[model samples]
Target: ILDYFELTKVDKEGKMLNIYLQEKNIAPDGHQHQDLESKGFFPEVEIQDFPIRGQKVALCIKRRRWTIKKTGEIISRDWGLIRKGARMTTEFGLFLKGIFG
Candidate 1:
């Protein structure tokens, strides 16, 4: 999940009773990417009962922005499917797909 990728600064928002979130960094180091094959972590994710919508509350990660923590460098990457499910989302997937996708 995002925590595994060291994603931080989690923020939540609600518009029309829908749920949304924002985060940054693929990892705590902010300069490395994890190997999904070995880590077995998904890139995108969806969350249910986010605001306790009685089975209607949901949140999905559609994109991400990757940058160096110190230098503010934007790393170039390829396009790929983001992990689905808020509990399953990872920072790596967001960083790549956010820019390329």
Candidate 2:
């Protein structure tokens, strides 16, 4: 799933719920992204009840962004799809790949 695409793992800075990449590098993550993506979701799942505590996708920028860490290929641009419930590392890394690639 997510691992199949190769995503970076990143964390949000400070107490805020926003996350971003440092130097636009591919974000990193520890989950079996491959397993999740294999569920056939990838960047196409309806997210509600975000899995993270006190974290929510409230901004447009927080909704779209994801890529393949290996090739730096963009998978989606929906922030709501990238934040919280899903791993931010792969999303951020792919975003970095988008601009840098």
Candidate 3:
């Protein structure tokens, strides 16, 4: 997909692209910690495609964020770009299944 993205426009390294992923996490609502619950929120995936463009390089995922909420617990899951440039593609759908399962 990077190759495809490159076709349209070069995404230089360190150029931050903000991605919003619907994450289920327990965020303090400032109400109470006594009764904690899992709430869905859009967690940002902040990362840069590395190596910098104009230098002719592959799309390198520099950084990303992922979180899972389990009331008194949090877990980090694996993330990968199943598709690039295109939003919510079939590959992205499969990636969700992999994450959920």
The prediction achieving the highest TM-score against the true structure is 1
Residue-level lDDT for 78 in candidate 1: 38
**Per-residue accuracy of model 2 over 1-101 as CA lDDT, tens digit each:** 33223333334545444332211222335432622221122333322322357665321122234455565555532233445445454566466568899
Candidate 2: where is the Cα deviation over 4 Å?
1-3, 16-51, 57-101
Candidates 1 and 3 compared: the better one by TM-score is 1
Error of 3 at 17 (Å): 4.9
lDDT of each: 0.42, 0.37, 0.37
Using lDDT, give the best candidate's number.
1
Q: After superposition, how far is residue 49 of candidate 1 from its true place, in Å?
A: 4.1
Query: Model 3: runs farther than 4 Å from truth?
Result: 1-6, 13-87
Alpha-carbon error at 86 in model 1, in Å?
11
Q: TM-score, each model?
A: 0.27, 0.21, 0.21
- Sorted by TM-score (best first), the order is 1, 3, 2
Model 3 TM: 0.21
Give candidate 3's error at residue 57 in angstroms: 15
